[model samples]
Target: AEFEIPGYLVWGALIYAIFGTALTQWIGSPLVNLDFQQQRFEADFRFNLVRVRENSEQIALLQGESAERQRLSERFGRVVGNWYMIMRRTKRLTAFTSSYAQAAVIFPYILVAPAYFANKIQLGGMMQTASAFSSVQTALSFFVSTYRTLAEWRAVVARLDGFETAIKSAAAEAISTSSIGVLSSAGRDNIHLQKLLVNLPNGTPLVSADSFTILGNQRTLVIGPSGAGKSTLFRAIAGIWPFGSGSIAIPAKATLMMLPQRPYFPVGSLYAAIVYPAEVGAFSSDRVREILIAVGLPQLASRLDEEAHWNRMLSLGEQQRLGLARAFLHQPQYLFLDEATASLDEASEAALYKLLEKRLPRTTIVSIGHRSTLEAFHQRKVVLRREGDRFVLQNQAEGVKSSSDAPLA
Candidate 1:
């Protein structure tokens, strides 16, 4: 406007800008989707590589080098394939923008020459008109030039949005009012379940515990046939499972810990890993060593200062022993062993049970095992019998009632 350029030049520039922008967006539109796929593919391939690295020993033992190479190649193939698509799309966009820029150099001359030839404007006026038109064209093509960057940024934003949405959705589902309710009951000596029905994520009822109470300071064993939702039952009491309805009223201020078949140990010093979920210095090194020795891990007694991935370095049986050591150190009010000792020999399992009985007699020990040897350790037995599609918790101490009658499922 300041240049006093011809109105026709402005009109021509506007038309050129509008068409350029449309074409740029049209050519680059797929880049957003392509970039998103590229990120996902890259992540998947990296994750597969990590998985292979973590399981390198197993792969080597199985002599699966050829199989793994093929698997990794397939994963990398997707990454390369999507990158090519992005490259092609970007090339097309670049070509169009390059031509558009070259055309813009002379576009002002074409518009102003008419006025100059008609002897209506001076040569300086023609030069000034072209300059002004070029400036406007640059401003308008700014979006076109930065379209690739914008697409990648948009793809990142989309992935972040999706990640946040998934996390929020999981949180929402976990706390949904329709799911099972876990509450702490004041002045209650026992853990109680009233009208509790544990269901799978798919809304299938797995176990029904209507009126169950686990008396304080007692050992209990839970046994059921395969696929009887044995582990799922304990998950409900831990307040981690949310697929069911009704309420589980745990004793007030009772500390509970569930030791799964595979216990997770952070990659750190043996002392830190053993007392995990507890700070490094929470338990004195001497105390952790004693606990480790008591758990029949005397071989690891002097290795408290050793830092490594205990989960990977130790065998499953060794890991289970470490898990027991953790329980002994933590001394939780209730300890649920979900086949935690299954890896150990029967004698070793018996010895651990004896140790628990002697050391933490007040702590309620709940074991889920198939061995008849477990019954000798527990005063009570809770069995899950398949009725229809789901299993119902039956207490041998009581009668054949649903989950509510039994203390632990």
Candidate 2:
């Protein structure tokens, strides 16, 4: 009877072990999927927060703080609510798994106890029977215990698949729908636009020009009303905005630079911030100091080694001056200023323009500004006027001819 009882216990253990492994895998898969999905949702929510922070200034100025806050709150609320759902599901799964495991330990003993009690096995035999039964049940219950993890894993796979799809869609759209072509113009004399059409982000026509050419080494000023597509035109020239149909032929060897009203400064040493598009050692330390002093930023000359967030460290006016100092150092063949000097006073702005005229006479200047003071620096003016649904550039006749009309030597 003792030997018979041991045989029965061994048989029970074998059966439990076989079933437990299969069940554990089945239950664990869903839990892993759920956890993975939760992580993806959390990442997306954080990305939105970064977007809000980057545009906080504009939002605050336009009194959009409440709206942005509400939007962010809605996004975060979804994240929290989804996480709670996932947690609850996990809790239920854990409860079931734990109970099943506990019951599994005792189930074999309960069944075999009848035989042992019936004088079928010794005490040692009975103890061994129970241990074997528990081992079998533990192995079989693996799936039930790991079900949550499996769910989380599946969720992660789904989120990653979705992100991939989104990236592909964005990339395809960028390639196929844009009409702006960036082509090479090896050593061309002028920048030409042929049958150019500029559009807004929504594909609405903003501007159309049949043919235009910006002569080399000639200063040209672009004037337009708000939202008249001046900046859009510039973006088209720079090959960033691809929503328009046109061909822009730039000089092959000409170096072009654009300085906006608010120039971006990297958060690092002042030296690194000054020669941004170039490496830190591109210019000598002394040359950078000289340019800074010339632009009325003598104080910053000593701070070249100091590391800080230059964007938030300097005011808008100071930043504009820094941008001009950069321009002086780079000395590009062509410079486009989109209200780059609007922040400074008229005197300072005039002085900086004069400095450019005096120092870099050969560099062509194309500026977009509302101030009349800017007209004195440029030889030609082009204004954008609204037609039916698009803007057209019209050249304005020059009233006062400057003395230095000769092409730069």
Candidate 3:
């Protein structure tokens, strides 16, 4: 009878151990998925705040602080609510697991007590039975304990998969029918656009042209109303805005640079910020110093090694000057400016244009600006005129006159 009781206890333990382990593993998968999702939500919440801070100036100028506050609050509220739900689910799982563990500890004693009372088992036998039963239960209940973790893990996978899908979709849109193709130069001295059709994000036609060219080493100014697609043209040339149909033939090995109204400055030393898109050793310290002085920023030359948030440190005028300094250093084959010098005074703007002409005599200069004073610096002017729902490029006779002899518009 004693041997029979020991055998029965061992058999029961083995049966429970196998079944318990399987159950635990099955349930634990979902909990792991849920934990992963929670982490993704936390990261997304932080990313939103960074975006808001970056656009704080625009929000402030538009008096959208309250609205933005509400929007951010709502976003954070969703994060908090979701976290709370996750925590509650975890709490329930923990509660059940703890109860099951406790019961497993006592269950073996209760089951083998009958043998003990009948003088069928010794103290050692009873202890061994209890240990085996607990091990079996532990193996079986793994899922119940880890269900929350599995769920979190699944959520994380889903979020990451969704983000990747979005990126792919964007890339596809950038390459398909909506994309603009920049072709290799065919020994063309001029930038040419053939059968170009520019469209808005919503697929609304903005500008359609059969053919156009900007001659090499010539200054061409593009003038249009606020929403007339000047900036979009620049984007198309840069190959970033793909919502256009056409081939832009650029010189195969030509260096092209675009200076936007608000230039970007990476967080670092002043010198690093000035020579960005180029390595640190691309220009010597003395060369950078000379350009800074030429742009009326000699004081900044001494602070070359000093690190700071340059965008926040310099005024708009100063930043524009720094942009010119960048152009002076890089000396690209073609330079496109989208209202790049709009922030400076007319005199300063004129001075910068003259300095550019003097320093970069061989560089093709294309500028988009509303300022009439800019006409005197350019050899040609192209105006975008509204035609039905789209704009067409019109070459004004004024464009044929040389800047040196042309009357100021």
Candidate 4:
């Protein structure tokens, strides 16, 4: 009778554990995908809030606060909707798991109670059988109690694996023969491009240039119709865009600086913003103040110690002026400006150009702009014309007049 009771209790615990584990798995499978999407939705909602904060000035100027608020609320709604689904699923899972645990404790006792009553076993034997049965059940039911945690772990692992794969693929392509290649040359006097083809990230051809040279001390302006891949060419030269074929050779040990339409400023003192990309205090405060005054930001000179979001607080024109001020401080060998002065008026733009010419006489300036006034500042013009599916660079020097000779018509 003792042997029979022990065998029966052991079999009962094993069957119970197997059934509970299978049920838990079936109920928890959906939670893995749900948790993955929940994380994505939450990240999206938070990113939207950050975007709204970054562009708050533009939204306020366009009186789009209500529209922005609606968009943000909708993003939050997605997060909340997904979270509710997770909660419902989790609640259902919890109910099953809790009942399974409680039932496990009582199941062993019920299986052995008949033997004790029938004089097949004493109280001690009954208690020992229940204890042995509980240990077996607990050992086998580990999955039932930890299924939710395992599902969450699986989702996290999948996300990390995807991220690592993307990073590796990008790194591989950066050195691939089919991608835009940036080669370094020993000379420090000229930038050269040999049969270079710059493409969009989707493998669509964007810009093509062949045997082009931008010499030191040259002021060149790049122009084209909208979407002609003007800014993209600059990106290719900077070795950041890696979606096309051919080689771009740059002078070795040369400093290159790119100023965009909207310059980014770190949230700190004016001195740091002006001398950015350089260590703070790299240039003396006196020098930074002089450049600020040169760029027509004398009012800012006195506020070098003030910390604020200069990009949002100051006007775009003011930001452009600061960008030029930074360039003046760095004195890079090659400077690429993509509509850097579009925010300023022609008068201010001309003055800034003059400041560059006076201060950075040896720095080669390659500018992308639509304003006719820009042509006056450049000694040469590089035009990008649509050719089949790509825009080809055509260097023009005929009738190319300096700003001092004739203003651009």
Candidate 5:
């Protein structure tokens, strides 16, 4: 035998690679699940911070600064607590990987040293044997070196899978529900609800009407007790609430707008907010200032060009005035109000309604309010009364009032 070099080096390198990869997988498996929780907890904490900033004014008004601070602290604590677990897991993983890497350097020499001492191989032959062993070990331990990256990738895949599943479920539900069909009509001058039944997302009936019609250019007021599905009815009419049965035929080429009690204004210039749902330059600056003054917000007229968070900067009563100002600017054929003036006093409420009557004489107005003073502005009144599990609409007797009895604007 020229050298009698042993083949144990080759077999030893393969065994070490297999053992190291398997151990690394076992130790790092928990990291995949922890990474997912850490991401969610961190995202939740960030979202809570944004929510606090958005509602900063309300929190200050309620003097709930300490409560909000405590809530934020609690949410942040979860983020920190989960991060600590990730760090510990990573620490353990690093310890094993580092040891495994160092051992591979000296391991080949240890296997070939015995053969060199027995005089079975020359120094050059022993060096070649060690180099070959090193190459095999490196190839086998590839997974061991990249274990952390694989864990993170697994977590990302899981989050994306959950998001995709949720979207598929919502789309499927929409396709399956064939009721609450919405049809648009061009020649008609009224809104028609035929065999309509509005229901909650859980299938509980809210409001039912066999046939209902809102004629063109009419002032109609809807009155009902608390939780009588008054707002839900408006949502259905707007073609947004889908948990219902029957068809809503809307006039074609007609514009409809809904004003809630607390109207939303985007964070931008007051001029932009005033003509929102309308493009910028839709109305002249002079026209916007004039409408602002007419709505009793003369102070804001000068600040039309000033950019601010108008919703947070303005009071509820002031916001309602701005809402009416918006209605005046847009002048849609139908304006639906859902307790849109609840924050204003009785006198101010009457003045706004009078302004609407004078400015939008042709626009059909529908209002939901509990106040008796609102009755004087509308020509017809309707009420929603509970009939079994759902509410049915009842048309009240038409009240007649001369122009002399109306409140002056």
Candidate 6:
């Protein structure tokens, strides 16, 4: 115990450092999973609260406050329950860390006490030894003290990494060489599809159109039975659905817009919502008001500056009008309307189409609808006729025709 007595401090610190680090790591491993779960629970609870707020009008009309409260309470209970679990685990970690720190402070003296009593070292020498031991022990316990912070930081980093990975994967698939291709045909007015095939994400073939042309400046209508992939065909032309092969040659420098059944309007002033995705001051206030009036939304003309959730505040018919207003504002060279007027009565729908023709005479319009009335608007009828195992938008005259007709141009 000659030289061994002097080295005892280092030996004791080394032993504790190994065991302490291992203990903290083992105790904190579960924190990552718990932290992630807590985040999900909290996010879900917040989402439900926002949903109720957005749909408050419908809830009030249905007198479903009690049902909403029950659903929200269940979500909140999960949030609190998961948070409690995190607290319990954190409590255990903090307790161990506190106990470890207190013991570490006294640990140096316990090691030096034997030499001080044996008279092998003076009081000053013992104190100095304890001080050096304390410094060394502090340096060695760095990881042990900060395990909680490390665990939480790792959780956030892991979640971000997961999101980034998912985004990259989706981007890669969308632009893959094997997927559908979008090409630009300069100086050409029409969009041409050569050997175009569209499929679902699961590789199920949906639409097959080879050597089909969407004639420029001509009003086109696409009609098919429900779930016949008519919408998917539109997506393919828009260059968003990439699960297929073949090239879609679009006119160069052409601005295209697609209005879905339920058009989206960002929560903001009527003027801003109507001309969304465009700068706020892109269109003059006077022109916007005029267009709103033309679309049969005279009431919204004066409320241009009024801020509200336009989608919820307006009925579906009114929303469709606003969607058309967006088209008129943008005046895109190509416009695809996917049942964009189905909510409106046949009379209003017909008026809207006529206004579209008058306002954007040069814009090529495509409409997707089930109504027989829609045929009166479009010049060329493209039916997604089922031939064998696939569908094509072949040309038709007057009423809906069979696949024996020529391909739609």
Instruction: Tell how far residue 187 is off in model 2, in angstroms.
Output: 3.3
Between prediction 4 and prediction 6, the one with superior TM-score is 4
What is the model-wide C-alpha lDDT for candidate 2? 0.80
Clashing pairs in 6: 395-408
Query: What is the per-residue lDDT of model 2 for residues 1-409, given as tens digits with 9 covering 90 to 100?
Result: 3254456566676666556556555544555655775686778789989888777777889999889889889888878877787777666666656766777778777877887789767778777777767766666556566566556556767778888998896566557646776566875557888888888868899988889888887778899898898887888888777787877888776788889889988989999999998998999999999999999999999999999988878889999999999999999988889999999988888788878888889898889999876787788899999889888988887674452542321
Off by over 4 Å in 6: 1-5, 58-67, 387-390, 397-409
Give the alpha carbon lDDT tens digit for every residue of 1-409 in model 1.
2447767777798899999999999999999999999999999999999899889999999999999999999989999999999999999999998998999999888887878899888888888888899998888778877888999999999999999999998788778988889998984468888898999888999998879887788888899988898899899999889898999998788899999999999998988899989987898888988888888889999999999988889999999999999999999999999999999988898888888887888898888999877777787899888888878888876422222222221
In candidate 1, position 318 carries an lDDT of 98
| TM-scores of all predicted structures | 0.93, 0.75, 0.82, 0.92, 0.86, 0.91
**Backbone collision tally, model 4:** 0
Instruction: List the global CA lDDT of all models.
Output: 0.88, 0.80, 0.82, 0.88, 0.89, 0.87
Q: Which stretches of candidate 5 lie over 4 Å from their true place?
A: 1-18, 56-63, 107-142, 400-404
- Candidate 3, residues 69-117: lDDT per residue as tens digits? 8988977877787777667666655665666567678878988999889
* Candidate 4: regions farther than 4 A off: 1-11, 114-118, 406-409
Scanning candidate 2 in windows of ten residues, the lowest lDDT window is: 400-409
Q: Rank the candidates by TM-score, best first.
A: 1, 4, 6, 5, 3, 2
Shift of residue 337 alpha carbon in model 5, Å:
1.1
Error of 2 at 349 (Å): 1.1
lDDT leader: 5
Tell me the TM-score of model 5: 0.86
RMSD, candidate 2, Å: 5.5
Runs with alpha carbons beyond 4 Å of true place in candidate 1:
1-3, 397-409
Q: After superposition, how far is residue 72 of candidate 2 from its true place, in Å?
A: 6.7
Model 1 worst lDDT run, 10 consecutive residues: 400-409
Q: What RMSD does model 6 have?
A: 4.5
Give per-model CA RMSD.
4.3, 5.5, 4.2, 2.6, 3.3, 4.5
- C-alpha positional error of residue 182 in candidate 3 after TM-score superposition, expressed in Å: 2.1
How do the candidates rank by lDDT, highest first? Answer: 5, 4, 1, 6, 3, 2
